[model samples]
Target chain A: MDSLDDYQIPYGLMAEFDTPADAMHAAEQVRDAGFTRWDVHTPYPVHGMDDAMGLGNSKVGWFTFCCGLCGFFGGMLMIWYMNAYDYGIPVGGKPNFSPFASFPVAYEMTILSGAFGSLFGMLFLNKLPRLHHPLLKNMRFADVTHDKFFVVIEADDPKYEEEETRALLKKAGSKHIELVNE
Target chain B: MANHSVPSSVKIAPPPEELERPALVENNRSLGWISDTVAGVIENKTPGWWKLTFGISLLVSLGLPIGLVYLISTGVGVWGLNHPVAWGWAIVNFVWWIGIGHAGTLISAILFLLRQKWRTSINRASEAMTIFAVMCAGIFPAVHVGRIWFDWWLFPLPNANSIWPQFRSPLLWDVFAVSTYFTVSVLFWYMGLIPDLATMRDRFRKVAGKVVKPAAKMRNKLAQFLYGLFSLGWTGSNRHWRNYEKAYLLLAGLSTPLVLSVHSIVSFDFAVSQLPGWHTTIFPPYFVAGAVFGGFAMVMTLMIPLVSLYKGLDEIVTIRHLEVMSKVILVTGSIVGYAYGMEFFIAYYGGNPYELYAFKNRAFGDMNWSYWWMIGCNVLAPQFFWFKWCRTTPWFIWVVCGFVNIGMWMERFVIVVTSLHNDFMPGNWGYYSPSWVDMITYFGTFGFFMTLFLLFCRFLPLIAISEVKGVTPQADPHHPLGGAKH
Candidate 1:
């Protein structure tokens, strides 16, 4: 156990709230407290929490839109090269480079890539596929999937003071508070 | 304290009618209650009926590999395919199975995007069905190539032959369309399952009591580990929920178009061809409507049995869900019927002798029996849903859906066989029929689909626990008026 001392670090302090309103109120205070490294968790998406947390509009839509555009052009270019430029053979006596003929494949590709981009972007933004989270070590954290709400302020935040932060969370009406160890 | 009680912005009180109707999930269930109920179903012992169904399905599914071995060794000639009628039961089955997959995506992705709250209980099962049905659909086109080994030729991979897939061809487009549809559906389904799987993980952990013996404790830890692994360490953190919700909404938007495009591209397999009965503009919308119709029938067929078999599930998967799905069947079935009628009218009104003969041949031709079967099952059968009794009764709906499944299959038969059996060149035209290999392979797909479904029911949370809980008023912590009191 002594040998493990070097590996251990202070993960964060987590505070639990009973309702979305309680969590949102706490989140607003924490945001005002100017803690950049923090988050709130709830069972389902609570409306107005993002605004309370001061999160910017998600960049995922842009990623999907760009990927979809690439798919469209990439599909167009592939068809143009294969049908018109490569070994051009007219089957129904139609034009080889007919845009009408290429629309279905291109449209399908656009959607395919757009969907892939959205899913991957979401995963990346959330930093998922991280199978071990410090938060998971706490059994009560599971309630975030069911009923309870939680907020965590990371120790790495510049203004994080252990006693002061605990006092702040207590004032915010957090019923149960625990230190998460890494 | 005032801020903590109820935010001024929250709209917890729903309309007056919401009180008149039964809850989408009955008994005024709480979030904890919903999770426990769904997870309880999975942890319980395999029921005798489930085991029996699985046993029968597994036994019948063996026919698939056996049929395939015979098909590969003996070659495509074992099927009833001839020169003129080159596309036989294989293509028809492909279209039918693929069309059946559409309703799952429609319910999960399309209805979800439309924010239909009632979809929450059923979406999980239907999405799983979409993936399984696509697996069944992908088999026909692969084996239909005769040389099963060279099916990779459908892919546009660079090879020694240096031949890329023809981008202009509808068959090649199907390769892209179906593959993309499969990939996206799986991702969407799995993404939705993560939160629910986490709920299951926690539930199992809770049951693995603290003071239990070492052996029991180890079992609990193992279960927790497995669930945790599948959940990707989901702690339901607020940050994760935000991104998850955004991803879900975006995926829903993408899939709505995908469901429509997939069947339309499948339709192109017929519409792009020069065949008089086949090449028509109506095929795309017509095919899409028919696919949705058939897909809903399959959903109803699967769901009716599931809710009845599981004790607590009937409360979650309420009667309203079935009634709503039945109404969808009625609407889409009518569209399919109208398309069939329009095909005839256009065939006669178009003034082309080839088209005229094709429509005439469909009604009074060699395969006229199939045409009437299609009409009787697809058109006349579902019109019974117009009555409240037929729509609400489970057995009645199931029987009607059975007709729908049969009718849809016959519709495909009428569409494919009728046009091909008599073409412009009378000498080349020939009748199509399924040999033993064709019939066995087709029957085996049902077994394959059911086997996967039973396994899914046994292992995974069949209904989404988290999603169902999310829809309940209890999940809304701040909305005391809307949600159940703590």
Candidate 2:
């Protein structure tokens, strides 16, 4: 029993807020207080919360743009290789390969690849499909999907001091605070 | 300045002429209420009507396989395909179903880009409709090609013969366009569903804890596990949402053009051809307008009853939503009417005798009844929406939507059959009508569509719960309910 208890580590401290405004204000405090490993959780993506949390613009667009370019050129190359270079059959006296004719298909491919990029990029950035997390086991944390908002400051954060962090969260207006364990 | 200071106790009213827009979610429903209402539909016991409808639809949906088997065994001759009227109900049904899919994309993608907050409540179900409708549409072109096995040749894949698909051909372009549209729509729909699925996962977890019966508990546990699996362990983290939102916005941006291109390519199937009526520059825009017109009608057709049948849905999918959709119908329907007139003007003004004859034949030929039906339903039915009473009344909107649905179908029928029935040579002229297999298969698609939709409604969130909450006043940090000072 002592060995098992020794293996357990404190995951984070979670602070519950009644509304998004309260959560946003707390996030601003956490940001200003220089907490690096902390997160705000809410039912939906609250407007202006990004700024409050000090998050810059998301990087998902770069993946989409690069993949979209590949899709378009890949589509064009496939057509050019299959029709013009390899088989070389002409119909209706038109050219074996014309970009005009291939534009629609290539355009479709661009969108398809761009869509793939957006989804996969998001998943990659979020480190999702993890299926397990410390906060997920916390019963009170479940309300983050319903109506409640929560801010979690990880124990691993450099500036994390148990008493000082707890006091700061209390001053930030969180009525309930609990320690989550991993 | 002194006079202005004397009004401390007086109350000033808002300007009478300024009309406040109706709230997106009625009755100022709380966030918990929104989640409960939406998740409750799936978590509660299955309704009798749902079971009955699902059973009937499952049974009726058999006609698709039955008709396909018979058609495959007997051949394409089973359909009403004469020399001139070679393209028949199959093409018409394909275009009709595909067109019906457009409104879903319009709502989910286009409206999102335009920042129309009202679209949040209806976008999920409609996107589901788009996917199913595309499935129905895909069946036609795949089967219409006499050899079903050879349908794989539509792609640019390398085979033994080493021949590639004609990139210039509109028929091949359709293969790429429709396939891409379907794939993108599913991706967008699934992405949107992730957050909502997380909500269901959490709720089911709670339910599993409360249930004492082992078997019932097992079922709840299974549901929770499946939802949790799909939800990808979403924690509603703002860091995750930042990327999630950007991805959603990009998808919406991509889907907007993809949706427009899909119908345009479908229109190209006709327009690129040398056939007098088929070869026209106006085909793309006209077809797009008609697709939007028909798609909204299908949305209304599905949503009106859904709102009424499902308890608590009426508040989320409010009368304002219906009225706004009705206005879209009126606007698009009028555009379709304008296109109809423009087609005639182009035919006469272009001074092509065959084009002239085709237009005249569409109105006065043996198939004239369909043309008039198209006119009555597509052009005139939506005119009722101009009246506030018609727009506000659910039953009236449903009835008008029904006519618009029929009218849109008739419009496709007239376009496909009428123009083709008479060829360049008089000897090629012949009357075309669908065989029983065509009718049954077409009807079966409705069953298939409904079955898929009913299953979606039963298992999934009918309304986008997270998105709907995002639009609510309570979700606003500056709003009083959100704890901001006035």
lDDT of 1 by residue, B54-76 (tens): 99999888889988999999899
Q: What would the TM-scores of all predictions be?
A: 0.93, 0.97
Q: Give the clash count for each candidate.
A: 2, 0
RMSD of each: 3.0, 4.0
TM-score of chain A of 2: 0.97
True contacts kept of each: 0.56, 0.84
Best by DockQ: 2
**Which pairs of residues clash in candidate 2, taking residues 3 or more apart in a chain or in different chains?**
none
What does the lDDT come to for candidate 1?
0.86
Tell me the spans in candidate 1 whose CA falls farther than 4 Å from its real position.
A1-8, A90-94, B1-22, B208-222, B481-486
Per-residue lDDT for B204-277 in model 2, tens only?
A: 88666789998998999899899999999999999999999999999999999999999999999999998978
Interface RMSD of 1: 3.1
List, residue by residue over A2-44, the lDDT tens digit for candidate 1. Answer: 6875778988999998767788889989988999999997766
Question: Residue A32 CA error for candidate 2 (Å)?
Answer: 0.3
Candidate 2: residue B176 lDDT (0-100): 96
**Stretches of model 2 off by over 4 angstroms after superposition:** A1-6, B1-20
